[model samples]
Target: MGYALTFEGLRDLAEGAAVLGTGGGGDPYIGRLLVEQQLKAGRTVTIIDAAELPDDALVIPSAMMGAPTVFIEKLPSGAGNIAALRALEAHLGRTAAATMPIECGGLNSMMPLLLGAQLGLPVVDADGMGRAFPELQMETFAVYGVSGSPMAIASDHGDTGIINATDNRRMEWLARAMTIQMGGASYISDYPMDAATVRRTAVPGTLTLARRLGAALRQARAEHADPFQALAAALSGTLYTHGLVLFRGKVTDVDRKTVDGFARGHVTLADLADPRDQLEITFQNEHLVARRNGRVVAIVPDLICTLNSETGTPVTTEALSYGQRLTVFAISTPDLMRTPDALDCFGPTAFGLADPYTPVEHLTAVP
Candidate 1:
């Protein structure tokens, strides 16, 4: 069946989405706040389990593209996001029966939730990538053979356009330029497909997982418990099963910049107990790779996330800074993302990392 997200339940959902966002996906604070406001005004957001989607139902997977840094400065013009989906519907010659998050990390997760509420549509209870990835082509939708063409890109200024390309990568390239022109951030709805395809492409239960993760954190806080332990336990059996504390330290250095409309940077963490044993985390919006004392401990396709050691709050790439205390956690990528085909598309080589791809399950020995 389906369920509605209540205002009271938002804390768990937001915190969980941040953990799943893997240190990217932009912060979920704005998204959560927006949803809370809507619910406070008596609006309802319904989420249907992926399996509940009818075989022929139309589902549009979407995301907000551009630097997370820019999104903060440029709040979306609500109509522009809905207009993009409407534009996609126009191109497809049909109305969408539902919407799905392209990736369930940070603000992007909130876009679909908020949009669904605005459009009075039910959101599928799953997402393309269980966690967030940096690019549009990094989704299970593409890996499972769905084309993201005949897409729609819209800006907050009532400007919308349809893009029909031969592949997903080209669409991203075209849409990216448009986002830059639209003032560095825009809403994009692509990979529109049917429920059958959605069941195959979507990472099941992620929305619910995000909620539970958030709830656990909230409970931990109430009891003055270790939120990190709560988070690890929450992720133990999902597709993101292999998760463990990789390092606990104080941030001593940060190098960041906006490159090609993406926030790219690395942070250095010095162990609180043994200052000389440092951990280096490199990221392109999302945390992508990590090394501990010169040994590669984690890499792309696996999550490398940092939480405030004291409060269990997530600290994304754009927010990393010096003297901040942190606990770094590594969570395995979904099984759908670990295959040979999926790996070639988003693995180390694809990200320009010199080392060959190695599983975090193997690298850090989470088992």
Candidate 2:
């Protein structure tokens, strides 16, 4: 059985995915827009169980890799997201029986929907990382020894290349260079695997889980209950902290530059309550560090999400600006993220911060 992804569906699913992003998944809004736009055009996305795939089924995961900021300005042109699929098929000499999301958050989640609708392929409901993280190697593929290499990447400019690196890390290096050369936006098709490999490594039913989380939040809000509370209940997740809107302002200052293929930036936020009190957020592709009142409140591996004070929608790190009125929340990471390997991939040092990674409970301790 398959379910169609919808705008209303994405709202809750995006929210849930962001919470699971652990401070690293690119904004879910971009993926939502891509998927919702296509769905509204009468395109349909179908999700299938991984178990249903045949042993010889060629499954390729497709996604965008590079600075999220670049994605907004240098958006996918010529169906850039789907280019990877075609590139991969050319390299493998066989058509993919299915497409699956590499991870479950933000852009990763919905791109599959868009690709599936465009190609008439079914999207498997399972995903590699139950939550979002920084590197390509952080997914279950690493656990299954699935190499991300021998992959294909393409851009809006109609340029495509296949990378056959020794391992996943090399694939990241090569893809980073390609993305930079392509103007900071490139889609990749990778981690070719058989059905058994896919089932053994991935978090089963993650797509279904994303949908359930989305539906639960929508239902709760409709019933006039706390949506966040409902989300916690659904994911076996814990809610940490919710703060007031410190600033409601426009992006007056943005310092962004790409170094070694990373989109790094600092966003200066002016407080709406007190103009003199300014806040600054530093990011590397994803939100990495946040500061307010001369104190560091949130850091990696603990989901730090910005929401509109009025609408309660998530704001992507790439979209953060000078004068946006937002209330930030700290959502604790799920158990899967706390494993030693998972933490090593995304903990404090992964973001290049000096502090040792601390458990989120310490920061968002309930009173």
Candidate 3:
């Protein structure tokens, strides 16, 4: 079934997408405002399940490519997304039946909605990554043999370029360089696929999941209940079924830098009760690995999220600072994302970590 996103629902979607983003996707607040502006103008953003898409329909995944830290300061011009999509459509010689998110995290999650509202096209409720990742090549679409090019990119100023790379990895490298030249960030439309391919490769129902996650957190807070508990219950019904609160503490140190078109660094947090008990999280645009007291509690391909300890609001990597109370939560990703082929693309070693990939459930079960 298909439905229109009311203004109220957009808020919850952004909130939930941020949590799933694991502190890497661009600011959801900014993305929310963009979508809200369109909705206020009486435009409707219709969301259809991937299964509802016609087999031959064209779907273009849209997103912002750049460091989330840079995106905070250099706001998009709003025209860039449309420009990219249009350029891609021109190159492909076919109109997009719909636009969809490349990742269901932070700002990227909202980019397709914004585009769909502006273009009056439906937005598919599926995405390449169930969560956000730093690099462009790290997507389920690419993992399942979708080429990243015939891709298009556009800057806030409407500067546009098309990439026709030999491989997805090369496509990312080229796009990253172009993003830097386009002033640290740009809008992109890529991995143009038929609906049948989307059904097979994309993570389905993430948009709905994000909305549900957001509603759960909001409802839990309204009832003065444990938001984490509510979050777990919400996950219990979704494809991402495992959720755990790994640590509760205060930020003690942050070593983040914007380099190579990424927010690369790590954060350290001390147990709220014991200064000696600490958790360290490393990231390259997203939380990739987490260690507590010298033990690996979580690693990539799984979700490592940071949230406000009390309010349960998600905190992005760029927002992490000293002395803020926080909770680090881990959730298991879907089985499709853990296969040997998928691991080859986004495993712990993919991020330069020495540890082997371990399921969050198994890692958390450690005494």
Best by TM-score: 3
Using all chains and alpha carbons, the TM-scores for the candidates as numbered come to: 0.97, 0.81, 0.99
> What is the per-residue lDDT of model 2 for residues 109-212, given as tens digits with 9 covering 90 to 100?
77777789888888988777765665677676775578887798988877889999988777877888888888876888889888778887777777766666
Best by lDDT: 3
Tens-digit per-residue lDDT, 277-317, candidate 1: 99999888898889999899999888888999988888888
* Clashing residue pair totals per candidate (backbone < 3 A): 2, 7, 0
Q: Which regions in candidate 2 have their CA more than 4 angstroms from the true location? A: 10-33, 212-227, 237-258, 266-281, 289-298
Clashing pairs in 3: none
Once superposed on the true structure, which residue ranges of model 1 sit more than 4 Å away at CA? none
Worst 10 residues of 2 by lDDT: 237-246
Residue 255 displacement in candidate 1 (angstroms)? 0.5
Q: How would you encode candidate 3's per-residue C-alpha lDDT over 94-139 as one tens digit per residue?
A: 9999999999999999999999999999999989889999888889
